[model samples]
Target: MEIPAPRRTRIQQEKRELILEAALEVFSTNGFRGSTIDQIAEAAGMSKPNLLYYFRRKEDIHETLMQRLLDTWLAPLRELDDIGDPLTELRSYIRRKLE
Candidate 1:
C-alpha cells in the first residue's frame, strides 16, 4: 500500500508558490519544450536541486501550471449570470474569456 504524503508547512507552501510563479514566467516566454529545470530554478532564485526537492521533474512543474491555468481560466465561465438573458450572458462570458 502507498503511504499518504505529509501535509506541507507554511514555508513549503510559500516556496511552491514561488516556484509556480517562476515557472509561469519562464513557460510563458519559452514554452514547454524550450524551458529547462535550470531555467525555472534560476527564475525562482533557488538551486535546481532545491526545485527538484519540491517537484521531482520538469514535467511536474508543467502539469501543475496547466492544472492551475485551467482552474483559474475557466472560473469566468462558471460564474455566468444565469438570471440574465442567455444570449447576452453568453456574449459577456465570451468577452470575459477573450480578455
Candidate 2:
C-alpha cells in the first residue's frame, strides 16, 4: 500500500502567518524605497529563495500585504450605514478605528 502525505497542521499555518507578519513589520519599518528581498527574508527567518517561493517578487509581497490590510480596514467602514443613529454610528466608527 502507498502511504499518503500528511496535511499541514494549524501550527504550520500559524508559522506562515508569523512569517508574513514579520515581512509586514520589516516592510513598514524600511518602506518600499529602502527595503530589499534579502532584508525581508532575514526578518522572516527564511532564505531569499524560500521567501520568493511564498511571494514571487518584492512587489508581489508588498501588493498582496497592502491589499489585505486595506481590505481589513475597509471591512468595518463598509459596515457603517447612514440609516443608523448618528451618535451610535459615530461611536462605533471610533471603536472600529481604535480596533
Q: Which candidate is the best by TM-score?
A: 1
Question: Per-residue lDDT of 1-99 in model 2, one digit per residue for the tens?
Answer: 999966768966665576678778888898887888898889888888877756778888788788998998888878787899988988998899898
User: Which regions of candidate 2 deviate over 4 angstroms?
Assistant: 1-12, 85-88
Which whole-number lDDT from 0 to 100 does residue 27 have in model 2?
A: 80
TM-score of model number 2: 0.69
Question: Cα deviation of 9 in candidate 1 (Å)?
Answer: 1.1
> Global lDDT of each model?
0.93, 0.81
Cα-lDDT of candidate 2: 0.81
Residues 1-99, model 1: lDDT tens digits: 999999999999999999999999999999999999999999999999999999999999899988988998899889898788999999988898898
